[model samples]
Target: MSKVVINSYEEFERLLGQQIGVSDWLEVTQERINQFADATLDHQWIHVDVERAKTESPFKSTIVHGYLTLSLLPYFWNQIIEVNNLKMMVNYGMDKMRFGQAVLSGQRIRMTAELHSLVNLRGTAKAEIKFFIEIEGQKKKALEGIATFLYYFC
Candidate 1:
């Protein structure tokens, strides 16, 4: 899908309550899970120890950490939209964030986002986007929540 470009607050305001865009599928490999584990110092067997997880874990495989999945929000959001003419953008915060399903290693996940609300605070733009991370071939979502971002258009 082509990216939705927002050059100004007015353009962003137009997309309120609409599905903005979808990101390409990203695979959660054991290597990625291990890298995240190393980066965060979280070496739980359910996330890193593949050999043990296969036998001990009910999932029969290593699962991606909840934080690891949540951390990819910005990455996926970038794929969904490109806000040009910005001096800078700040991650305002996230609200109503929920983790619904576990992402097993090797499963592909993609995100769908909607522009839930848009408000202009003087010159700054506050965009509240509702996003859902879905695992390929799974009916349940891996994660879902509202992410707020502040855009400073130049």
Candidate 2:
């Protein structure tokens, strides 16, 4: 893997509108979703009951919870190119978010982020990255959001 280096805030701003690479696909397993449901106390039939899903749910299969899908971001994001020599980076938070479609269990998903905005926060760089959570081969987006991250150089 190449070491991605950002020498200064200007460098990150220069990356605006550029498409970061597609992350490796993450499989949405029923077991994982079930575990998430159990942990969150969300035992909705659409998420936990496979038999009922097949018969009643429009997806015809158990689906991963939207929050679970969102929570998987850190794993999917690690596949992104990193800034070499950066001291630390923080998940500052998201500015806006929307769940566009359902993620069915047994499916795979990946992310494509575009640098949308960059601002200098004194010594740190604050960036707004728009992410499209893409389900392989699907035209509809599973999730869309503008995530903010702060990168500080020591």
Candidate 3:
């Protein structure tokens, strides 16, 4: 596929609602979950206590932190498509966010990003994108939400 260069406001607007590629699966390992738990100071039993979780938790194993799922957006976004020739791009904010399903540790997940909306912010272009994070080999989606970003051209 061709890379989209946001040269002008009109060019950015033209790409709205475009279909981006889905990312490859990223494994949610127990160590990664623990590290994230430690970093975030959210040392909950459901995410960190694997032994206890196996007996008490319905998942029968440790689960990935919700923020971990959210944090994967950048990695997933890179896999979708390339937005070239920009001085910088910044994450503006989320218009909407939803965790459709919990991600269990040891599961693999990927994202499908669709361009949702676009607007001109002063001279920069802002894009609102919706990302659906699918859990591998499962019907449940781990996460789905809209994220906004501001792209400034050089």
Candidate topping TM-score: 1
Best by lDDT: 1
Error of 1 at 129 (Å): 0.6
* Model 2 C-alpha lDDT per residue in residues 1-154, reported as the tens digit of each score: 3223566777767777897666888898999998999899999999999999999999999888999988887776667756645689999998679988899999999888778888888878888888889887789989999888888866
- The pairs that clash in candidate 3 are none
TM-score, predicted candidate 2 vs. hidden true structure: 0.89
Clashes of each: 0, 1, 0
Each prediction's whole-model lDDT (CA) = 0.94, 0.83, 0.84
List pairs with backbone clashes in candidate 2: 4-84
Q: In lDDT terms, how accurate is model 1?
A: 0.94
Which whole-number lDDT from 0 to 100 does residue 96 have in model 2? 75
Model 1, residue 108: C-alpha shift (Å): 0.3
Poorly placed runs, candidate 1 (over 4 Å): none
lDDT of 1 by residue, 1-154 (tens): 9899988898998898999999999999999999999999999889999999999999999999999999998899989999999999999998999999999999999999999998888899989999999999999999999999999888
Candidate 3 Cα outliers beyond 4 Å, as residue runs: 1-11
lDDT of 1 at 19: 97
lDDT score for residue 99 of model 2: 88
